[model samples]
Target chain A: MIRVQSEAFDAGAELNAFSTQAAGAGAVVSFTGVVRDVTGGLSGMEIEHYEGMTEKALGAIRADAMQRWELADSLVIHRFGRLEVGEVIMMVATASKHRKDAFEAAEFLMDYLKSRAPFWKKEITADGADWVASKDEDEDALSRW
Target chain B: MQVLYFAWVRERIGVPREEVETSAVTVNDLVVELRAREERYDAAFADTSALRVALDQELAEFDAPLSGVREVAFFPPMTGG
Candidate 1:
């Protein structure tokens, strides 16, 4: 499942629900990204996304992960709009019969989500707002798979 | 067709989207036409290397042909997740 929305969600509850739906899976790996306080230099974050494309991009990648890994199930939930410090920005959960598959799949999801998804993030600081640049490492990470 | 901008590109171009009538054959050709229209568009598209393009919501190359494409989007490299 892939969800793109402006509403905040409970990571704990989401993980629990994902685990339950994964059925006989023996391993579940999940990741949660939060708005870092940046030593209080950051006040908040604003996320902008392509309304029609965000969902399509996420679903395509989720399906790719399912085909690449031996996964029982997978979930991706990414939020948009104003997000305060410490707020959960996104979550990824993958369940499989082995830890290796679950772990690798989760990492793959994160890597692809960083660049392929059509969502942009701008950090709001005391001075002004700036869009986060795409990291070379993030692009390099994709060459692995 | 519709041309859309995002992030700083939208801010620079001063609008999120607009309808444009064009006969450009490729994304690069379209960029050239947009750059000719106004100073803001020229500024937003000043650096082709710093930009990314999508055709009908799918990522594509600047050299990608615009044939049969109804929507075009230009923005900086995505900073998602």
Candidate 2:
């Protein structure tokens, strides 16, 4: 499952849901991305995404993850709109028979989402607000995998 | 067609939303269609090098055809969390 939402989500609650859905899986790995107080010297963040298109882009990311890993189940949730620091901004859950598959799949999904998804984030700092672009390193990380 | 902009592309284009009509059939063709409209569009698309596109909300390649697509979006590489 994949979602692009505007409201915050409970990581524990979502993990429970994923575990419940992955009845036959032996391992589950998940990651929750939160709004950090600092990024590349920026103090805050504001995320923006095209509503209808965000969903489509995230779905493709999820589909690719499934194809790349032998995952029994997976879920991806991303929050849009204004977000305060320390709030949950995104989550990815992957379940497989072994921890390696689950962990690597989740990380791979996050890397692709960070670079290829349609969502854009703007950094708001003491100086000014500026739109954040995917870095060359970020792209290289995905390409290397 | 509905043309939407996101991130810095929206700021550079000076608008978040717009409606356009064109006979272009692919994402690249559509870029050409928008570029021909005015200088602002040309400037916005000046460097396709830094841009990416989506058709009907899904990430798509420049060669992807646009037939029956309801929405087209253009933005730089994502910085998603």
DockQ of each: 0.92, 0.75
lDDT of 2 at B24: 90
Q: Is model 2 an incorrect, acceptable, medium or high docking prediction?
A: medium
Best by TM-score: 1
The model with the greatest DockQ is 1
Give the DockQ of candidate 1: 0.92
lDDT of each residue in B20-63, candidate 2, tens digit only: 88789898999988888888889889999799888877778988
Please provide, for model 2 over A5-41, each residue's C-alpha lDDT reduced to its tens digit, 9 standing for 90 to 100: 7887898999998998897899999999987765556
Using lDDT, give the best candidate's number: 1
Candidate 2 accuracy as lDDT: 0.84
Off by over 4 Å in 2: A20-24, A39-43, B25-29, B63-69
Q: What TM-score goes with each of the models?
A: 0.99, 0.85
DockQ of 2: 0.75
Candidate 1 residue B75 Cα shift, in angstroms, is 0.6
Interface C-alpha RMSD per candidate, 1 decimal = 0.6, 1.3
lDDT of 1 by residue, B1-81 (tens): 999999999999999999999999999999999999999999999999999999999999999999999999999999998
Error of 1 at A53 (Å): 1.1
